[model samples]
Target: MDMTGQRTLQVTQQQAWEALNDPDILKACIPGCQRFEPSGDQKFAVAAGIKMGPVSAMFNGSVQLTDIVAPQSYKLNFDAQGGVAGFGKGESSVEIKPLEKGCELHYTVHSSVGGKIAQLGQRLIDGVAKNMAEDFFKRFEAELEKRYPPAEEPIPQQSAPAQTSAGVPVWMWAAGAAVALAVVVMVTR
Candidate 1:
């Protein structure tokens, strides 16, 4: 899947970039993140619990940050495995553009999955990925707001749609797929 989105923050571009690189900030912002530890320079070991469809899996992962351009942008290379559930690997670039009030942060992600996770189907996985992204950003924004409350109340950020295709949310799609799978199994038996 490929993702492209932008968010405006009430903090300076430099502050936003710094927050992105902070392990404590990231751990606080990441949903279901159980452990996030620095491995070495620009590397981290992460363990997270993820629930998609009917399967809840624990994923152990590593992330590497490279192609740094200071406060402007950086590339994130990440890979994770959930044992029997399969694996996911991806790269994303985050760019920060200075704005009048603060900064405009843009990110693009390209990712792929294989094994049992792939058997769950694209639309289902896409929905999950999109929802997870939205959740992560929301948490990040909230954390930033807590740290840097504006003089005046900042306007609530726009939320991306839960489901970008077929007009159904991720959870609904997961439920539908689960029902369909159950039916197929019953009929085969």
Candidate 2:
């Protein structure tokens, strides 16, 4: 699978790059992260609990950063194993561009999986991966906002709108139901 995405953050490129390298910040941002530790200057070992369909597993992974280009871009090689569930290996590139208000983070990844995960079907796997990525960045961006704040403007509270009352979007509720059904079917199959 190939995936690409970009997000603009309200912080300088330098600050964004620095935060990206911080193990503590990454641990806090990564969803289901059990442990994340730096093994070397640009290498890390991580363990995360992931649930996809019925194939939930604890994944242990290593990531290596190469082709050094400080604060601009770098290549990431990653591999992870999840016992009976499956394994994943991939390569990606992350680029940072300084914007007037903050920074733009662009990433592209080419990845593959095997075992039960691969058997789950491309649409399911892709959707799950995309959701995971979105979740990670949401947390990461929140953390960065807390650490940096805005230079000139104060951050706004994310209170739910009165229309939703509970703040849950109707579409999201439907999506959740759909995913639950899909998971049930996938696991049973």
Candidate 3:
């Protein structure tokens, strides 16, 4: 499977890069993730519970970051196993571009799967992948707000939603890919 997406973030490029690399933030942002710990330089051990359609399983995996360019971009390689459910392996590239207000996160993923999960079909797998991505972003945004609240400004008569401030790093992008891959594995089962 292949997937691509982008998000507008309410934080500077530097800040987003930093947050993305933080293990705590990544762990929190990845839905159903139970563990996200460093195992080596730019490598992490991961365990996540995922559900798709009528299937669910616990996936154990590893995510590695490569071709890293600080506060800008990186590539992620991920692999996960779920016993009888099946397995997923993939690579993703993530880039952060500065914008007038904050920054944008762009990512692309290519992955393959096998085992019982593959029988579930492509449409189901794609839907689950997209949902997992959305869930990750929501959690990531909330974490950013908590860690770095927006600067206080006087409220205007017409109140607008206050923007939160934060950042992400290359590692975070890797984590996102890991989460997406894990979810895909679950769907296949």
Candidate 4:
């Protein structure tokens, strides 16, 4: 099966890259992911419980990152076993681009399944994969927001009350006029 999609994340490219490579963040974001830990350089050991149609199983997998470009893109190769349920092996490429407000993540997956999972029909498998991808992104964005909240708009600085040509504030002129009027009123009385 092949799948491709893109998401606009409300985070900087560097922030997105760091979260993607973090084992803790990935584990929390992945649906039914029970374990995700680094095994070696650019490699991780993973276990997740997945249910598709009437079949459910715990998949043990290892993922290795390759073709890495720091804070930009990488290729992931994964292989997993679920005993009688089936096995899945695949490669995916992920790319991150900086957007005006945040960043865009693009991913492509090409994977194959065997054993009973393969017998479940292509449409079912595709639907499950799509749902999993969407779920992952929703969790991922929530995590990002928690880790790096959007910067406040600086509270606008109050702007100094619109300075005049002489560099005096316009509010100062109004205050002077009020004071002069008060002085005239007191003298006339």
Candidate 5:
């Protein structure tokens, strides 16, 4: 099946890019993912449990990230087997663009399936894929918020003139000094 979609992430493109490259973040973000470990550069070992139609299966997969452009885009190649439940292999391209308030993630997926999962019909497979995609991004957004929430604006510090140790304002002292200076200047003139 062919699929395409976009998600607006409440984070900078660079942050989203870094999280995507992090295996731990991806593992946590992926629904039903049990394992996602780096095996080599741009390669990861993946294991996830999923139910498609009525068949529940554990999918062990390899994911390869390629054609990467820092903080912008990458291509993902994935191949997985579910034993009697069949198999799936696919490639997906993801792109991120900085928005006024956040980043927009765009993705395109082209994939195929065979065996029992494929036998479940295209509608079911498509629905499952869509759900997985939505779930992954939803979790990813939450993880990003937890890890790098927007910095709160710092409160302005009060100056001595704004408040005094005693209940009297420091500005009163300054005014008194200024009056004294004026008197001295007038007398000197």
Candidate 6:
């Protein structure tokens, strides 16, 4: 399947990049993720429990970061297996752009499933994937707020109280893209 989207965040590109690569932040933000232990440089051993409809499974996976261009973009390769439930392998890319107030994250994923998961109708699988994507972003956004709350601007005591400009922060998490599909498909079949 092929998917693409972007989100804005109230952080500098460097801040976004750092958080995206932080193991602790990723483990906390990923839905159903049991562990996100770093196995080596730019590599992680991941375990996540996923539920799709009535199916549920614990997926064990590994992810590698490649083609990195610090604070700009990078490519991620991921694969996972869930016993009889199925398996998935894919490559994805995330590009970060700096904005005046924050930054934007753009991602594109190309992945394939095998075994029972491939047997599931594409429509159903796609629907589930999309929903999972949205859920991942929502959780990532909340985590960002909790971990890196935006600084509050002081109100001017002059003619008018200064108003803080609220940037449209879609929230940035490169890790969000890396594991979202790995976990979502763990239970598909």
Each candidate: how many clashes?
0, 0, 10, 0, 0, 1
Candidate 3 global lDDT: 0.82
* Candidate 6 ranges beyond 4 A from true positions: 158-189
lDDT of each: 0.80, 0.81, 0.82, 0.86, 0.82, 0.77
Instruction: At residue 132, give the lDDT of candidate 4.
Output: 89
Across 70-154, the per-residue lDDT of candidate 1 in tens digits comes to: 9999888899999999898988888899999789988888888887888888998988888887778777877787887757545
lDDT of 6 by residue, 1-189 (tens): 888888887678988888788878787767788998889888999888876665678889998999999989889999999899899788889988999988998999888887776777788778877877777777676777777887976644576433334532222233456368335521110
- Candidate 2: worst-modelled 10 consecutive residues by lDDT: 180-189
Output the number of the lDDT-best candidate: 4
Cα-based TM-score, every candidate = 0.78, 0.79, 0.80, 0.81, 0.79, 0.81
Candidate 6: give the clashing pairs: 8-170
Over 1-189, each residue of candidate 2 has an lDDT whose tens digit, in order, gives 999888887789999888888889888878788888988877899898888887899989988989869898888898889999999889988899999868888989899999888998999898988888887887887889799975564535657632356778755776699688544420000
- Which candidate has the top score in TM-score? 4
Weakest 10 consecutive residues of candidate 3 by summed lDDT: 180-189
Worst 10 residues of 5 by lDDT: 180-189
Q: Please give the lDDT score for candidate 4.
A: 0.86
RMSD of 6: 9.1
Give per-residue CA lDDT, model 4, range 116-183, as digits (tens): 99999999999999898878887788899899986765434674578899999877997799688544
Tell me the spans in candidate 5 whose CA falls farther than 4 Å from its real position.
153-189
Model 6: lDDT to the true structure: 0.77
Which regions of candidate 2 are displaced past 4 Å? Answer: 153-189
How does model 1 score by TM-score? 0.78
* Cand. 2 Cα-lDDT: 0.81
Cα lDDT of model 5 by residue, 1-189, tens digit: 999888777788988888888878888888788999988888889898989989899989898889989989888899999999999898889899999977988889999998899999999999988888877876777789899976876656775447668767766877789688544420000
